[model samples]
Target: MKIYFANGLFALADRMFNEVVVDKIRKMDSNIEVYLPQENGDINDKMNYADSIKIAQEDNKELLSSDLIVAILDGDTMDDGVASEIGLAYGKEIPIIGVYTDLRQHGVENPEKLKAVGSIGENPFAYINNYTIGLIKMNGIVVNNIDSMLAEIRKYL
Candidate 1:
């Protein structure tokens, strides 16, 4: 299976996902091919107009070609880039596997939620972005570890 590991480029999301999930998945199946955006994308430090275009093109190409997308929903909320990739996968009818480890609640834009999260580290009512979480649930399962992800993949494949 071809898998797209989507996450933020600037943050250490790539490295974290690589260490926690990608390595194990690769070792588990010889036939599986994983595409990591931070590692495989053509983004440069300068990030000229052409370079940005190239990067987006490369990422989108990989996303479209992949059979599954394992989006890292790290940080307090889902990263914007990862959300965009998820949208692409949804449009293409590609299965999405959300890897969210941050127990912190997201979408704190609401005043009540922000107040709740202020008292506690995370709001129990909202664990992540509502739409993103709902979307993932609709297409695929959201897992906290590689084991669940593997199980879902096995069942799906």
Candidate 2:
């Protein structure tokens, strides 16, 4: 199966995760294909951030065409661009798997008071913009480990 990997690109961990996941998937099935954005090069110095977004938009189109999307929704919060990719994947009716390394699922930070008035389930001081919201709404599974992520993919593959 063809897979589109989504994650924070600004961090080295993102690259590590992609490489690890791709290697794992390929080991599972050498015929499988993975798609990722081209590494930023001298072009980034030539254009502004907006141009980089334009490049990402085109890359996302390709991402959406994949059979499934494996997204890294880790860190303090889900990356805005990654969220947009999830939205686009949902719009295309493609299956998604959300991978998160952060363990704030219990809503620990800002426990003083809730920011979003009408919230429930540890919402009083929810941190990280409730990363699970989009994953749940998109009918995607939230996995905290690479093994689980690969297992989930195997189900679809």
Candidate 3:
């Protein structure tokens, strides 16, 4: 399977996390081929310079050819590039497995947490853009952790 691993790659933490996740995914199956954007330093390396068109074109080419997209959706907001990629994948009928591991998304069943929603500035939940999430749900699914993401991918396999 060809997998496009999409996430924010600008920060050191983000880059390291991407590498670790991709490595785990690769270990899952020898036949899985993952296209990690960070690996394409020509376009992603901050020290180097690549034009916007070059970056978009290169990523689009890989995205179009991919069998699945593994999108990281854990952030204050979804990365703009990752959201755009999700849109394109949706339009092209590619399945996506979104990993959203925000701790704020937990404790939904806690009554105190639920009551907090009635108070101003006391909401205990994190919000992800419904439209972007809708696009994913229409063609795929959103998972809360890496294990769930991998399990979903296994279904595709």
Candidate 4:
């Protein structure tokens, strides 16, 4: 299946998605194609407006064809572009598997009291954005690690 590997470009998540998860996915199944946004060098904040539009179109095409999305929601909150991709995938009825393991970055309204309020089961994303996490849980499963993500894929797919 084609997996859209979405994540924030500003952080290490993009690199990890490519360097680590890509190889793992390949080993699991050589035929599983991964649509990595970072691999497309055209999409950049340094580019001109027209160029940015062009790149957005390119990314849109990738999302359109992806069979599923494995998003790394591992920053302060879900990256805006990644969130847009997830929304598109959801509208298309494409399955999204969100892998977010960070425990101390939950974006709670009341830092102390609501830190664990939005958690579902052991996924105490104590610092993750509530709406973002909720959206992920609504459309897909939130995995804490690569192993759990792989297991979920094996079972679901």
**Would you estimate the TM-scores of all the predictions?**
0.77, 0.72, 0.97, 0.75
Q: How many residue pairs in model 2 have overlapping backbones?
A: 1
Query: Model 4, stretches more than 4 Å misplaced?
Result: 44-50, 105-125
Best of the candidates, TM-score: 3
Candidate 2 structure quality by residue, lDDT tens digits, 1-157: 8888777666677777677777788788876787765343422233444466676766666786799888777766777877878877877788888876665444444435436435656344325445445654466787878889889988986
Which stretches of model 1 miss by more than 4 angstroms?
12-16, 44-50, 104-126
Name every residue pair that clashes in candidate 2. Answer: 114-124
**What's the lDDT for residue 130 in model 1?**
78
Clashing pairs in 4: 105-127, 105-128, 106-126, 106-127, 106-128, 107-127, 107-128
Order the numbered candidates by TM-score, best leading.
Answer: 3, 1, 4, 2
Q: Worst 10-residue stretch by lDDT in candidate 2?
A: 38-47
Q: Is candidate 2 or candidate 4 better by TM-score?
A: 4
Better of 1 and 3 by TM-score: 3
Candidate 3: worst 10 consecutive residues by lDDT?
A: 148-157
The alpha-carbon lDDT assigned to residue 80 of candidate 3 equals 95
Model 3: colliding residue pairs: none
Which lDDT value does model 3 have at 38?
A: 91
lDDT per residue as tens, model 1, 1-157: 8989887767465566565677777777788888877565246343533465787888899899999999888776667889999888888889999987654434546687767766746555535787887888888879876688788767745
Candidate order by decreasing lDDT:
3, 1, 4, 2
- Candidate 1's TM-score reads 0.77
